[model samples]
Target: MDEAPKALQRFLAPFMEQLTQKNLGNAVELMNEDERNEFDRLLGLATEPVRSFAPYTF
Candidate 1:
């Protein structure tokens, strides 16, 4: 259960490193600050729990 971060890092670190290594800053710069903030907010919400009946099932 606890290895999630390591597993994610293993999968994502290379892509992130490649992005930095390749300097994808232009794509990043294309997004306005407000858009970036909104995207981040949506991403955080996406990672959070939503109302569901699954937990009550037996």
Candidate 2:
């Protein structure tokens, strides 16, 4: 069970790195106008700041 998570993490690490903002920005340059617009909208939703329900600040 413990090894399963570690193995999955190792497999996904490279893909996770490729999904960074810089890489995504570069990829967007290749997209058409409509694709860019849709990607930006989805990225905005994915990256929107989360709201905290706690009273104390981090």
Q: Give the best candidate by TM-score.
A: 2
**Mind sharing the TM-score for model 2?**
0.46
What TM-score does candidate 1 reach?
0.34
Query: What tens digits encode model 1's per-residue C-alpha lDDT throughout 1-58?
Result: 2444455445344445646454435434555777556445544554555557687678
Residue 33 accuracy (lDDT) in model 2: 80
What ranges in model 1 sit over 4 Å off?
Answer: 1-27, 49-58
lDDT measured at residue 23 in model 1 versus the true structure, 0 to 100: 40
Best model number under lDDT: 2
lDDT (0 to 1) per candidate: 0.50, 0.55
TM-score of each: 0.34, 0.46
The Cα error of candidate 2 at residue 55, in Å, is: 7.2
